[model samples]
Target: MVNVFITGASGFVGSHLTPILLAAGHKITAIARSESAAQKLEDQGITTIRATLEDIDVLAKAAGEADAVIHLGFIHDSRSYAESVEADLAVITAFGTALKGSNKTLITTSAIPVAGVPTPTELSPGKIPPRAASEQLTLSFSSPEHSIRSHVVRLPPTVHGDTDRGFLAHYIGQSRKAGFAGYIGEGENHWPATHVKDAVQVYKLVLENASGSLKGGEVLHASQEAGITLKTIASAVAKRLGIPTKSITKEEAGQTYTFLALFLGIDCVASSELTRRWLGWESVEKGVIEDLEGSGWYFEETSVTKF
Candidate 1:
């Protein structure tokens, strides 16, 4: 059994991932910032470590003891993007220091938006959007000399699924508030997407085959749908909410959207062909619009929490 250390173990992706890993006979050491969260993990037969991303020593110690580490925790404050990236960089540095020259595996999170090139590829080289330093730090420790098998999973901007209170949820909530579902400028900009289940499986495959299946410093896109038009996403939400979909100016969008405005304006089409070829991974699930409209249970539940 692989002794895996995972940050963000109680969050959306991690919550789904832990059970799968356990079913496969992997032992999990998960980090939780609250007692309630820690208790939840412990209840599920996981070893809980009480700490936040700020606890570098705790992270380092946990990572040092594990056979592998998956870094998924990040500060979600969009207003403080710089601080969040800095924390990620520091946390990565700690993991690298602890696992240096051990050839142990480390998998961290990046976003498809960071693939600055128009057509995103696994080999596309660029600083991650908003925070370039963090990705650079992650890729730098992935050499044979460092002896750390490192990789970055570039997640699509929207990973939709059950209990998901992400960007799509925010759109639904805003649609309820504004009396209409809105898209920015013609809404032609495209955003890649994947179901949470599919995305988590990609992570599992990468972790299971880290030492052999993937090259160090490789960037894998977790996108199942290469790109779905913003207009399509808006139409889906509008249809669900029984509201008209309208195009809003960027200035109007700034006032309308909370933290998702900047992202709504971006067109990121990421390709996972290389990741699929290398890891034998494929996303066999409903696409974003289908999930958002037909199967997604989030809309049936409470709209009180706006995330």
Candidate 2:
């Protein structure tokens, strides 16, 4: 079994991923910034390193000690998004330095929206998105000369499951605040989605197959439903919150949705067929619309004001 070092181990996807890895007999060492977070992971028999993403030296040391590294830790602050991206880049660079010429696996998390194309495949080039720099850098470290088996898992817009306080939850919260759930101009823009359960399996498979056919600098999409329209998703949220659905203009969306305005109208349709063929990975969970309409957890009270 591999000794894996993970960032964001207590996060939504990471929380689900950790237990599965442990069950599969892999040892996990997680970085926890808070004592409570550390204690919680420690209680689950995970070794905890008390550090944040900004602790590059600590992160490098931790990366040097592990057989593999899964980077899921990202600061979701829209107000300081550039800073968050910088921190992510720094952490990735540190990991690459520690694992250089080691041929160990390094899986970094990115989003499907990073691809500006109509239908993004694994080979689709990243555009000028917020996290594009980190994605490019991660893939660049996969050269045989570097010997770092780096892979980037581009997660869809909606990684839905219970206890999720992501973009979907933010939409739900916005719906609750406003009388009606709003979408931009006919709301035909689409978003790719996947369940948390299905998304975590991609990470596991990537780690497990690192020494096999899986090569460095490869990009994988964990998207299940390729394209769920914004109108459909908005309507689902409105129905769940017992609110009406409204069509708002782009200007109004900016004013109402604030930082989430751009994402609300973005059309990011991504395909994971290559990833499925490469790793034999199959998505076995409900899609975003299904999960939103069927699950009661999405409308629950939670603080999701930030991105």
Instruction: Give all TM-scores, in the order shown.
Output: 0.95, 0.96
**In candidate 1, residue 267 scores what lDDT?**
87
Q: Write the per-residue lDDT of candidate 1 for residues 1-307, one digit (tens) a residue.
A: 8999999998878988999999999999989989999999999999998899999999999999999999888877544778788788889999999999988889999888886766788888756555556677778888777888888898888898887777877777877788888889899989999999999988899888743767688888898999999999999888887889999988877788877787888887888999898888989988998887785465664654434
For residue 273, model 2's alpha carbon misses the true position, in angstroms, by 0.5
lDDT of 2 at 268: 75
Query: Which model scores highest in lDDT?
Result: 2
Error of 1 at 194 (Å): 0.3
Candidate 1: stretches off by over 4 Å? 77-79, 304-307
RMSD of 2: 1.4
Error (Å) of candidate 1 at residue 213 is 3.2
Q: What ranges in model 2 sit over 4 Å off?
A: 77-79, 302-306
